[model samples]
Target chain A: MKLDRRKFLNMLLGIGGIGGIVSIIYPIVSFLNPPKSAEPKVNSLKAGLNSDFPENTSKILKFGRKPVILIKTGKDQYKALSASCTHLDCIVQYKQDTKQIWCACHNGLYDLNGRNVSGPPPKPLEEYDVKLIKEEIVVTKLG
Target chain B: MKKISNKLINWIDERYDLTPVRNLLQHKKVPMHRHSVWYYMGGVTLFLFMVQLFTGILLLLYYRPGEDSAFESVRFIVTEVKFGWLIRNVHSWSANLLVFFAFIHMFSVFFSKAYEKPRELTWVTGFIILVFTLAFGFSGYLLPWNELAFFATKVGTDIVGVLPLVGEPLKVLLRGGEDVTGATLSRFFGIHVAILPAIFSFFLALHLIFIQRQGMHEPEKFKNLPEEKKKYIPFFPDFALKDLLLWVVVFNILIFLALYFPWELGNKADAFAPAPKGIRPEWYFMFMFQSLKFLPPHLWFIEGELFGVIAFGLIGLVWMLIPYIKIKNRQNWKYQPLTILGVVAVVFIFIMTILGYIL
Candidate 1:
C-alpha cells in the first residue's frame, strides 16, 4: 500500500514520539533501580560476640548501609534496631542513662522496643532479629 | 478504531475548542532562506535544556546534599552505580552545551536584528533565560564538593563580596556563613536543584509563549523582499520535522560525549586543607576570572578589584537595556552601537578565556 504525505508524516511523528519517550524513561529507570554494583549489600551480618554485648550496655554496629543499635538488656537477652531516625534518617544513639534511642536531629525519640516514643519521629525504628550462635551474635532483618 | 478516535476528538472538542489551534498550526509558516539554519539554534538549545533536566533529575536521586556526603555520594554515583557514569557525564556535558548554544542563539538573533521593535520583550525574556542558564551552571558547579569546586566557589563568592554595600550580606546569604563550609554546599544544592529550576521555568515559559505568539522573525532583507520572491514552509509538518531531525543528531552527539569523556570525580573538599593550585572556574566563567586576575591591587588608591566589579556591573546593565538604548532606530544593521558592542563583548570574552588558560 502507498502512504500519502499526511499519513507518512503522522507515522514519522508517532515513531519519533515513542523513541523520545523511551529515551527519557530508560535513564530514569536505570537511575532509580541502580545497577547491582552500585547497591550496597544490605543482608544479615555478624554484630559481635555475645560476651562483648553485656547487660545494660548498647553498641552501634555497621549493618550494610545503615547503623544498627545492638542492646543487651539482660544476660542472653539481645535486641537490635536500626539507628536511623524515621523522621530524617539521622543516626540515632542510645542514651544509656535514659535507656532510650535518641535522634539528635529535631529531638526525635524511640523506645527500647524501637517504637517512636516521642518527638518528631513519625514511624518506629526498623527492628532486626538478634540471635546467638555459640559465641557469635548475629543480626538479621525482621520479616 | 478510527471512528472511536474521531468520536473521542469530538467529545473533547465539545468541552474545549481545538479547531483554532489546529488552524493556527495549519496556516503557520516559517520563512525559508540561507540563514534559516540559525532558526534551529533556539530549538537545539531547548533540546539541550531538556537533556539537562532529565539527567539532572536522575543525578538528584542519588545525590546527597551535605558537606560530609556530597563528594562521596557523587563519587559513588560515577564510579559504583551502574550507568551513573553516563547520567552524570551527560548532565555535565549537556550543561556546557546548553550555555554554548544559548550564546550562539543570542548572537544569531543579534546579527539578524530580530530584537527590533515588537520583539523587545521576547529578547528580554531570552536574555533572562541566558542568565538563568549561567546561574544554573554556577550553582550546580559546587554540588560535587570537590577541591576545584570548593576553591572556585570561594573565589566566586569573593567576587560577589566586592559589590558596594550589598556585597557582604549577599556573600553571607550565598555562603550561609562566614566561609564556604557545609552551609554553602546545602545552599548551593538547594538553589541548583530546586530554586533556580523553578525561576528559570517561569521565564522559559514566557519566552516560549512570546515566540509562539509572534512567530519566528524574518531577517530585514527577507522581510524587504517581494512577497512572490520569498519562500515559506509550514511550521507543523515541514519545519517541525527538520527540528526533530536536528534533535536526533544532537542526541547522538550528547551520548557520544557522555560515553567517551566520562566526568571525573575529583578529590573530596576539605575546608581546613590548603587551597590547591590551578583551581579555576568553568570555561564559561573564565573570562571574568581572567579579568579579575588581570587587575592590579590598586589603581591610584581606589581598589582595582572593586573597579573591575563595578565595570562588569555597568556592562551587564548596558546589555540588559540594549533594546531601550536603541529604541529609536530599527531596520538597519550598519554602524549600530549594539552590534558593535556585541562584537566587542564577544571578542573580549574570547581573548580573556584564552588568557585565562594561558596565564
Candidate 2:
C-alpha cells in the first residue's frame, strides 16, 4: 500500500497517456460535426489577359469547379479544352514540342482540336468556347 | 492514494485474474546479442503506428470528404486550424516511418529465419499488416484532394485496372465509378478511417499475440552457443525500458521532421485541369510506380501494364509463402535461394525508388 517511486512514475505515465489520447480524440469528434462553410461558385471565368498566354503555350484556367486548358496555337488563335483527360481524368497538357495535348500517364495523346489521337484514351477532351473580350481571355463551357 | 489504488487493483484482479499475465512478464526474457537491434524494429514500428492512429484521428476532425469540399477543407486545416499543420505532417511522416520500419522488421525476420517454425502465422500476420499499412498510405493520399494526389490516384487505380478478369470491376469498385470522382473521395475516406484501421488492428493484435506466445527467435548461431555464455534480460523492465527509450528517440526525430519539413500541400485538384509535370506516387510506392513505367506498351498478346501487374502479384505471393517454401526445403538445406531473393528484392526496390526520383 506504500507509494513507491516506481509506482508514482507509472501513475504519471498513465495520466500522460490518457491526456495524449484525449487530445487526439477531441479534434476528430469536433470535425465529424463541422459547422457549415460558405463556398464560392462560378460558371464562367476570365482566365487571364491575352498576353498571359504566349504563342504555342498552354494555360490552365479554372472554370466553375474544374479547370480548362487554353492553348494559344498561333497569334490571335486560341483553343480551349477541358483539362481532365478522358482516359482517367488527369489534367492534359499542351506539349509545345509535340504540338499535341499530351497525357503523361499512359502516353495518351490528343490533337489541338481535342480529338483523341492515340493511346488508351477512349474519348476526346471536352471542347470549350474561348472568347477574347478586349484584352482579357474568357473561357466558357460548351453546349 | 496508495492504499485506495491497491484495494482497487485487488478487486479488479480478483475478477480478471491478473496473476498469469504478471507471471508471464516476470518470466519473459529477451536474448542479448549483436543482432538484438533488429528486435527493436517491431516495437519501433508499433510505436509509430500508435502515433499514426493519434494524428490520423486529429486529421479526420477537419478533413471534409467530398469532391467539392475535400481540397478546401484540407487547405483550411493546414493554413488555418490551430496545430493542424503539425498534426497532419506528423500523421503523414509517421505513416511513412511505419512502412519503413515494417519493411526492415519483415526483412530481419526473413534473414534470421524467424518465420521458420511455429511462428509462421506470426510472419503471415505481420506481412498482412504491412500490406494494410501501404493501403493506408494509398487511401489517405487522396484525402487532401490535391492535384498531385488526384492524378497519382488515377494512375494508381489504372494499374489496378490491369488485373485479368476482375480488373475492370475492381477498378470501378475502388474508384466508385468509371473515374476518380466525388464517389471516389467518399470511398477512400471510408476505407482510410474505418475499413483499413479495423483490418490493421485485427492483424496487428494477432501479430503481437503470436510474438508474445512464441518469444523472440534466437538466430541459429545463438542457439548453438553454450548456455553459460549467453546473456538475457527480463522483458518487463529491462527490455521494455529499452523499447521505451527507442520510442522516445523516434518521437524526437518525428517532431523535428514535422517541424522542419512540414508536409507540402500541392496545388488544389482541378478535375478538368490539365495534368501537371513530374507527377509521382508517395516515396513508398515509387518502386512499383517506376517499375510499371519501364513496361512496354504491349507484351506479347497481353497489354504491358496487365503483364506488370500480374508479375507484381506473383512476387507478392512468393513473399507470402516463404515460410512454407523454406520448411519444404529443410531436408536438403543447400543454397539459401530465398535469402538471395530477399537481397535482390531489396536492391531492386532501392534502385527503382532512386530511379523514380531521377528519371
Candidate 3:
C-alpha cells in the first residue's frame, strides 16, 4: 500500500524520535551493564621510605593507580592503609596530629591501622602489606 | 517532447510564488527591550547543554564506572591521557553552568508572568526540563569516584530514604543496593549520561514547540504595553536565529571561564575517609539542603527528613500543576499563592545558598 505524504512524514518523525532515544540510551546501557574489572595491575605496589614518613603523620603515596597511606610507627616500621572513604568513596585525608585517616567529606574517621572509629564510615580502611626495603617503603595491597 | 515537459515542470516549480520561503529567509523583527539581554540566560543554558554533550562524549572515551576500574580509569583520564583533564573540566564546569542558568531562566520566565495565558504549557514543560537537569547533576555526581561525589551521593540518596513508605525502596533502587557501591555508580552513570538527558531533551523540545506555536507572551502592562509587540519575528528565521546569535556569545563566555578558572578535580573518592562537617552540595542545591536544616524534628508530628520530603515534593507538584490553574473572569490574573511562594522559594534558595557558603 502507498503511504500518504502526512503519514510518511509522521512515520519518519517517529523513526527519528525513536532513533534519537535509542542512540542516546544504547551506550549508557552498555556502560551501566557492569563494567569489566580492569585487569588488576596490582602486583606489589611500591610506596615511600619508612624512615621518611614523619611520626603521627600519614602520607598519601601512589601505588600504581591506588592510594596507599604510609604512616611511620617506629624507625623501620611503616603502616599502609587505603585512602578511600567507605561511605561514597571521597578521598580520605590523613591528619598527622590525630594519628588517624579522616574523610572530611562525610566525617568518617579511621585509626592509623585503617579501622573505622566514628561517624558515617560503614567500613574500615583496607590495609596493605607494608615493609621497608633498602630504605624504600614497599606496599602490597591486601583485602 | 519529454525534455520540454521536464523543463516546463522545473520552471513552474521554481516560480511557484514561494513568497513564504522568501519572507522566512529575510531578516525579520526582534524584540528590542532593554532587559532583552537577560533573555540570554536561556541561551546560555542551551549553549552549555551543547558543551555538555560534546564534553560528555570526550569523557566517555576514558571513564570507567564500576567496582574496580572506576578509580583507576579516573586517574588515567586526569593524569595520563593527553588533554583529558581539560575535557573533564569542560564537562564538569559546563554541567554546573547549565544548571545555574536553567534556574535563572525558569525564574525569569516565572516572575515576568511569561507563563500566563497561552504560554502556560511552555512554562510547565520548561519546569520539567529543569527537574531533569538537576537529576542529571545528581546522577553525574558519583561518576568521578572522588570524596565529594562519593559522600555527597551517600547524603543525597539517604535523603531519598526519608520519603514515607517507598523511601527505602527508592534509595535501594537509586543506589542499586543498601549502600553506595559499584552498582550505585553504574546506576547513576546510566541516569546521568543517558536517562536524564533523554527526558530533558524531550521536554525541552516540547517547550520550544509551544513557544513557537503560541508565540512569545505579550506584556500585561496596560498603559506601557509596547505597540511593536504584535509586529515581532517568527520562530524559524527571526527569534530562533537571534537565540542562535546569543548562544554563540554565551559559548564564548563559557570557553573563557573554562580556560581561566578550570574546574578543580578533587581527590578520588576513598570509602574510608572521615566525613567532613557541613558537607554541602552544589550552590544551587544548597538552599533546599539548608531548608532541610531549618526544619525541627517534631514539625507536625514528623521528623525533619520526612517533612522535607513532603514539602519539596509538594513544591514540585505545584510547579507542574500551575498551567492548569484557571483564573476565570476573562482578564484579571489569579493571585495564586503558588506565584508568591515560587518567588519566595527562589529568593529563599538564593539567600540560603549564600548563607550556606558563609556559615
Best by DockQ: 2
Interface RMSD to the true structure, each candidate: 18.7, 6.7, 6.9
2 versus 3: better lDDT goes to: 2
Model 3: how far residue B54 lies from native, Å? 1.4
**Candidate number of the best TM-score:** 2
Per residue, candidate 2 scores C-alpha lDDT tens digits across B317-359 of 8898788884344657765778778899999999999999998
Where model 2 places Cα greater than 4 Å from the true spot, the runs are A1-89, A105-143, B327-335
Model 2 chain A is weakest, by summed lDDT over 10 consecutive residues, at: A31-40
What level of docking quality does candidate 2 show?
incorrect
Q: Model 1: clashing residue pairs? A: none
TM-score of chain A of each: 0.72, 0.69, 0.69
Name the weakest run of 10 consecutive residues (lDDT summed) in model 2 chain B.
B326-335
Residues A20-111, model 2: lDDT tens digits: 99999999755543233333466568878887778999888766556688899888789999887766557788899989999876577899
> Each model's DockQ?
0.01, 0.17, 0.14
User: How many angstroms is residue B324 displaced in model 1 relative to the true structure, after the best TM-score fit?
Assistant: 1.4
Better of 1 and 3 by lDDT: 1
Q: Candidate order by TM-score, highest to lowest?
A: 2, 1, 3
True C-alpha contacts between chains kept, each model in order: 0.00, 0.37, 0.25
